[model samples]
Target chain A: MKLFRMLRRHIRDAFKSVFRNFSLSVASITCITITLIIVGLSIIASLNLKNFTTEIEEDVTMIVFLDADTTEEQISTLTVEINSIPNVEEVKFKSKNTSKNEMMQESDFFKETMSTWGEGDNPLKDSFQVKVKDIEKIADTAEEIRDMDKVSVVNYGEEMVNNLISAFSMIQKVAIIMVVALIVVTIFLIINTIKLTIFSRKREISIMRLVGASNVSIKIPFLIEGLILGFIGSIIPIVVIIYGYTALYNHLGGVVYSNLITLIQPEPFVYIASLIILGIGMLVGMVGSAGAVRKYLKV
Target chain B: MDLIRINNVKKQYKNGVTAINNLNLSIKKGDFVFIIGGSGSGKSTLIKMLYREEKPTLGEIIVGGVNVAKLRNRKVYVLRRKLGIVFQDYRLLPKQNVYENVAFALEIIGAKKEEIRRKTLKAIEMVGLKSKIHNYPDQLSGGEQQRVAIARAIVNNPKLLICDEPTGNLDPERSKEIMDILEAINKEMGTTIIMATHDKDIVNRMKKRVVALKDGRLVKDVEKGGYCSEAI
Candidate 1:
């Protein structure tokens, strides 16, 4: 019975106080919204960047130009041997003639050069192209391919592959750092806003206590107020993220088309993931208000 | 039968002042007792001791057969339910209207909604503030506020009604009116009334039992009391 009375009064007091201090409450809500938005956007950006890096890693393949003196049996043997290496997904064979033909199709200028080469003494030779099972192990696969027999030369832009891998790792590191930093800011802002709301209701709080209001009843109203503000705040950022994402996508449509290698770039999932991050912001506000009121009530 | 028994209760302040000392008394259920003293004669301290708001330095107090001096801190809420306390300042919540303030006592104790409403209305009528039921504490005059405070005190139908200078804030006519209401409550309800006041006017007219203190000691206990104008 006492619990019911306290719960009812707590509801009434929280609503009255929240309405009574509208401007300060709004200030708290806006701050929470902005915090959630930034955190959310960053989360979405990080997740998409991760997926992009994985796609790029899967695409990386190494082409081995065979020795000029290698025979058909040796070439076949080499293909079998190369395929046996750890992390090798598949080995594709391209004959010397097929390589020249592919080069010729690239341009009319390359066709002339291709036709000038003598038939018997064609410098192009059959080679094996190695696709790695996992992109992360591309460097190790390349190193093992270097020591294989009948393999004259291995060609894959080692520097480019290394730079791409490093860039992906850096993106992940930076994203984690950004997430940690934003969470701290969100908590601080949310806590301060809750504190202000609590301050406004100090008088009402005293009356409740003097009237023998239970601690739970006194806390529930403030807790609800905080959650409402935080929930409202979380929405603002999601909208901003959606607006900014659509605008960016519209204006950068050409860039996305031209640059197929977007491994380090954030995609649409980044935006959705950012909205989830806003949920965390809401949680921070909720817990913060509850904590502050618990301290203040001390009953 | 004895409803309250106090034995040698003492309270010494930090400034080396003895507020209450070796206080011994016994009160019955129908007793209307006034604890009186000069300004620094420990009257207020003695009243506070009854509520356990201030514990005694020595001895014991039992109210309604419960050992109040040894009462657990959290259990004070239980003790307070049977006890209705009124302060000199009225201590009426400023934001609440008379009816709400009166109902507040029931709300804390979780009374039934209809019962709370019915009883609050009755209390308001008893204090003759039914017309001002919706008025806030500040809107009413000093006397009205005190009456509201009294209405709040009696609304719970507590066993013991302790008034610590409840009429101290009112004028002579207003004071008389408050005393008359208290006297009527005493006659009708059989509640134990323990009032602490330095007021000489209301003390004389009540013609009830009076206990006087001088410099932390019980100096006089009178059957028919009057103002201590000569002592002052």
Candidate 2:
């Protein structure tokens, strides 16, 4: 009962000080808000980039064209051989007639030109669209398929795919670095702000010390004040992150063209991001106030 | 019984200045003792040493049977809890009302709500500021502020009340009222009062036990002494 009363008093004093020093408290909250906003944006950017990269990885497929003169038996055998490759996930065979028909249905110019050609005059070659389990091994799998019998040409946009992978990986690294740097800067700013608040109340602290207030009693109010500031600071940023991400996702109409690149769905992603922001705000506030109050508590 | 015992206590500052040198003194329980000394004569240092604010460089200061010099930082609050200290500057929290300022002393020590209300009101009444309890420190005169400081210092009913020039900023009439309160507390409640002061008139008028210091050494101690050795 005594401990509960003391905690109540400490919490009351914490709120009282925050209200009494309104300007300083606002400044602290502002610093935390801005810092968390930057952190939130960085997180969102990293998440989107991650999703886009995964889309790219899944979209990469090796197109293996067979020799035009290959017989049906040879085409079937080649299909089985291609499917047996280590990293090949699935091999889809496209007959020349089917390919020609798809081309004729896709465009009016192709239909006009292809209507005069018979099945025997079809110029399209039979090909296999090979999807791979892993993007990194796609190039090696394509290379292996190139040396196979009846294989005429292999194309998976090798250079473009590698460049895209590297670019996304670099973005991921940079995003991590940016988020870490922002957190460090936020902690420094929050600590200094809390130090100022503690400085203004140094007289009160000394008076309490002389009056026999224990160190824990003296520290509890400031700790609570810090937590309140951090909590208030995170609210705006979390709202902004959720709102801004939803808006961006809607504005983009979809992920990227071809439906491969996509934004993380708003529901669970925003909820998780909000949790992260709240956690960072509270943790930073605790650490900053704890560090600042330690020196002045020597009395 | 001796409530405070100082055995060959010596205090040297970090700058190599010796504030109290080879000082030895003792005060009995319920005794109203006046520490009379000029500026820089180590009157403040002696009072500070009693509260464990400044540790003696040489010897032990046993207050209520606890060695203050050997006490750790964490235990200092425990020792201070048993004592009340009033300063010359009247260190009242400017933002707190008179009532809250007095109650703050009790609040910090985890006193019960009813006990705090009862004791805080009682202390404020003793200081003769019952009507002005709602006023802030800035709204009060220097004497009234000092009274609030006194009320705060005594609110916890400390075993020993140490006042360092408590009436230094007040006029003669205000000083008399403050002294009268302290005297009443000493005589009526038998709380040990050790006051450091330069107010010769109040000291001479009170005719209490006086301990005088000169250049960090105890030069005079007398029973029923006046402001100066020759005056009595």
Candidate 3:
């Protein structure tokens, strides 16, 4: 019961100090809010970029064309050879007939041009549809398959996919670096501001110590004050993340330019992001306040 | 019984000035003692050491059975809680009113609300500042502020009270009022007091136990004596 009363008093004192030093508290809150907003934006961008990269990775497939006169036994041998290559995930044979039929279904131009050809006179080449376990090593797997005898051509839109992957990876790295740096700056900013706030009250703290207040009792109020500042600071940024992200997603039609580069769904994503912002705000506030009190207050 | 025992205590500052050197003294329980000395005489340093503010370079100081000379900073609060301290400057929180200021000491030690209110009021009444309980520190005169400081010190019912120039900032009339309160607390409640001061007239008039210091050494100690110029 006595411990509970002490906690209550500490909380009350913290609240009173927050208002008593209104300008200093506001400065700290503003710093937290601004940094959290940028951090939130960076997090959202990085996560969405990651989603786009994964979607594109899943869609990448290597198509290997075979010699036109390959025998059934030779085709079976070729399938086994391709499967044995490192990183080869799955292989499916597409007969020239199936390719021709797929082309016909795609447009009337292919249908008109190919309908006159008989089964023996078909000029289309058979191909193997291949997938790899690791997209990073897809080029090596494709090179191995292309060097095999009787292989005509291997194409997986290599240049475009590689370029896109490199670009997205760079952006993701920069976003993460930005988020981490901003949090660090916020921590230092809070420490300095809280130091100023407590400097004026150093005498009060000494008097408290002289009157026999324990170190923990002296620290509790400042810590709680930091928590309150952090809590208030996070509210605006959280609102921005929830509302701004959903609005942007809606404005861009849930995708940036194409279906492959899409935004995360708003339901759980924004809520989770808001929770992260709140957590960061409170944690940073507490840490910064603790640092200030420990270094400056002496008690 | 001796409530405080100082044996071969020595305090040398980092700058190489020895504030106290190989000094020993003892005070009994419920004794009202005066530590009389002039400037740079090591009286303040001695009082500061008693509160563990300035640790002794060597030796042991046993206060209320606790060895304060070697006590750690983290545990200093335990020793301070058993004692009341008053300063010449009257270190009251400017923002806190007289009642809150007095009640703060009890609140820090986790005293119950009812006990705090009763004891805080009683301490203030003892200092004759019951009428100024609602006024802030800035609103009160120096004597009233010192009374508030006194009330805060005694609120926890500390067995030992240490005063360092408690009447230094006040006029003769105000100083007399403070001395009267101190005497009443000592006689009525039997609280041991060790006060450091330079007020020769007050010291001479009180006729209490006087311990004099000069150049970091104890020059004289006498029971029921006046402030002596020969000792210096």
Candidate 4:
């Protein structure tokens, strides 16, 4: 019952003070909204960028050429064995003639390279293009494929996979750093705003002090006010993020024209939006309230 | 036993100026005592000590069983709940109405809603400002504001009511009215009243015990006291 009463007081004071200092309260809310909206958009953009990179990495494959003398029986057997390798998703073998025809389709010059080979001579050998679950394991899988007697040359370049992984990690690190900086700035700005409000009401606080109001009574209300500001500020950003991410997806789909860039699914946008809202809101509110209340409540 | 006790109390300013030096005094319950001192003679500091706003430099002040000088910040307000402090400036919040201002004291101490309303209305009526209860402090005169302040201070029904130059800003007639209200509160409630004043006419006319301070020293203690020159 007492706890309820205390909570009641906090809520009452928070609402009263907001009405009491309407302009300052509105300014604080606007500041938080602008800051959080940018933060939320930043998060959504970075996450979508990450999803695109991962899709690219997953689609990458290694082509392993088999010895020219290998029979169709050997090629099929090798394809089965490669498929059984852990994390190797699927192994597809393109016969020598089929690869040559596909290459020719890419460039008319490749047809000349193929025309020289007579019917008795096979210019190209069958190759297995192995798609692995993880891009990082591409090198190991290719090395294993090369050691097989049926394979003559393993053409999977380890450097390309490594570069992709490194690029992804770099982007991840940059996103994390940006998020951290935004959070810190959010905390700093909110705290300074709360401090200014407290300074404006110092006279009233002294009167409360004179009346012997408990430290918690004085602090809880301001803390609730900070929370209210945080909550109100985050609403615009969260709405913007949901609508913004969906719009970006539709825009990306139209702009790419080739269906090349993979878009983020709608489900993850919720997780991202929630992360942006609660992460910045709770941190900014709790920390700013604590700092301001410490200055006002003597205890 | 004394209701309030001050033993060899001393107060010093930050710039090495001493306001009150080795002042000792005591007041019994139901006694109407007046503290008289010239300006800068530590009247404010002495009043502050009673409320635990300013602690004595070197003495023990026993008010309602607490040693105020050694009290913590949390304990200061607890001590204050037992006190009714009326300031000269009337320190009423400009935004609050007369009723809200009076009820604020009870609210801080967690008074029940019904009781706070009852007590606040009763206190305002006691001060004869019932009609002006809804008016803001800025709308009232100096004397009415002072009366409102007194109502706020006494709303909690504190055991000891301390008035520091409460009539300092009022005219003679207004000052007398405030005094009359305080006297009625004292007579009706039997609450101990300690007033610090420089107005010799009012102090003398009230025919109460007077404690006089000079050069930061308590020089007189009288029963049924009159303001005489020897004390200064």
Q: In candidate 4, what are the lDDT values of residues A1-299, reduced to their tens digit?
A: 66676678669878787777888888888888888887777777677677778887877878888788898788778878888889799878788888777888888798788878765596777788888997777778878877888678887667777887998889978987898788678778878887787788777777777776777677777878888878877877887777776777677763244566666776676666766686678668767876777776662
Interface RMSD for candidates 1 onward, in order? 3.6, 1.1, 1.5, 2.3
lDDT of each: 0.78, 0.88, 0.89, 0.83
Q: Of the candidates numbered 3 and 4, which has the greater DockQ value?
A: 3
- How many clashes in candidate 3? 0
Which 10 consecutive residues of model 2 chain B have the lowest summed lDDT?
Answer: B223-232
Q: Return the number of clashes found in candidate 2.
A: 0
Model 3 deviation from the true structure expressed as Cα RMSD, one decimal place: 3.0
Model 3 residue pairs with clashes: none
- Give lDDT tens digits, candidate 2, residues B1-232: 8999999999999999999999999999999999988888899999999998889999999998889999888778888889999999998887789999999989988889999999999999999999999999999999999999889988888889999999898899999999999999998888999999999999889999999998799989998998884322
Per-residue error (Å), model 1, residue A106: 3.8
The digit string of per-residue lDDT tens for model 3 on A133-176 reads 88878888999999998999999998987886688678778877
TM-score of each: 0.77, 0.90, 0.90, 0.88
The per-model DockQ list reads 0.32, 0.65, 0.62, 0.50
* Residue A248 lDDT (model 4): 74
Question: Predictions ranked by lDDT, top down?
Answer: 3, 2, 4, 1
**Which CAPRI quality tier does the interface of model 2 achieve?**
medium
Q: lDDT of model 4 at residue A231? A: 84
Alpha carbon deviation, residue B6, candidate 3 (Å): 1.4
Better of 1 and 4 by TM-score: 4
TM-score, chain B, each candidate: 0.95, 0.96, 0.98, 0.97
lDDT over C-alpha atoms for residue A252 of model 3? 92
Model 4 earns a TM-score of 0.88
The TM-score measured for candidate 1 stands at: 0.77
In candidate 4, stretches whose alpha carbon ends up further than 4 angstroms from where it belongs are A70-121, A132-149, A157-163, A254-260, A266-271, B13-15, B228-232
